[model samples]
Target: MKITLDRVNENFHFKLKNERGHIVDVDSRAEFGGSDLGASPMELVLMGVAGCSAIDMISILKKQRQEITSFRAEVEGERVQVGEAKPFKDIHIVFYLEGPINEDKAVRAAQLSFEKYCSVSKTLEPTATIHYKVVLNNKSL
Candidate 1:
């Protein structure tokens, strides 16, 4: 997979393009770009991880005969600044599952997705510390 980034202005704003010709704009706080409109490279990486896990978890739950009422994946990253590079040293994922399914089964499904299913998590494992937790119905149970 190859992507190209083009500078949109003299500022930090840029346009990203993939090999498939899809384009997305990225910018910094100096511009009017907000989180929803633009994201930093690190934010994009976190988003990729979250999106991958969400897809995997939902698919796994569906296969497990669970009906999902609501699902949310929140990801937080801790970055280590070394000179000019800022890499994510730790990443935490909170998987929120709200439904009538068994809590244990839901947790297991999410764990499986992070450990074995999500490609993003697997790819980033060697570089970043990835941790995940499943919260069911506002309780640990």
Candidate 2:
């Protein structure tokens, strides 16, 4: 997969385009002289993790014949300084699922996503610790 980045302005704002012609805007934090036009690169990394795992979990659950009404995932990351770069130290993902879904199936879907299926999480696994929790119908599973 190839991606191209073009500067949007004289500053840190840029637009990234993939081979499929999808676009994602990227910018630095305001403190770094950016205008906050879009999400920062670090934030996009977290987004990738959330998105990848969401797809995996949803696909797994669907294949298992679970009835899903709504699903949402919240991802939070803690960063640590490494030389001049602040990289994520750990990431916590909370999945909230609603519907007449089996609790164990929901939990297993999440487990499979993080432990085996999600490529984005696996890419960050060496540097960042990944943790996930599943909440099914307002109850932690």
Candidate 3:
């Protein structure tokens, strides 16, 4: 996989394109002299983790014959400032699942995604403590 980033101006505004020709705009916030055109690089990392695990959980649940009505994930991260390197200290994903899906199965699907299937989660596991919670039918489990 290849990605190229080019500066759109003299500042941090940039256009990123992948090998598949997929493109996204990336820039810093207004305080950083950027126009806030798109997501920051650090923010993108969190998005990747969320997207990857969400896909994994859905796939696993579907295979298990789960009758999911609606699914949503709320992901958040905390970045620690240490020296010149700032990295995520922790990441949390809360899954809101609705339908006839059981709490146990929903939890297991999330576990399987974070622990076994999600590449993004595995990649960040060494640097970040990944935590997850499951809520089924408007009830937190």
Q: Candidate 2: where is the Cα deviation over 4 Å?
A: none
lDDT of the candidates, in the order given: 0.85, 0.95, 0.90
lDDT per residue as tens, model 2, 58-111: 999999999899999999999999999999999999999999999989999999
Best by TM-score: 2
State TM-scores per candidate. Answer: 0.85, 0.98, 0.94
The order of the candidates by TM-score, greatest first, is 2, 3, 1
Candidate 2, residue 50: the lDDT equals 94
What's model 1's lDDT at 16? 97
lDDT of 1 at 123: 89
lDDT of 2: 0.95
Clashing pairs in 2: none
Query: Whose TM-score is higher: candidate 1's or candidate 3's?
Result: 3
CA lDDT, candidate 3, residue 72 = 91
Q: Which of candidates 1 and 2 is the stronger one according to lDDT?
A: 2
- The 10 consecutive residues of candidate 1 with the worst lDDT sum are 29-38
The prediction achieving the highest lDDT against the true structure is 2
| lDDT per residue (tens digit) for residues 26-75 in model 3 | 99999978899999999999899989988998898899899999989898
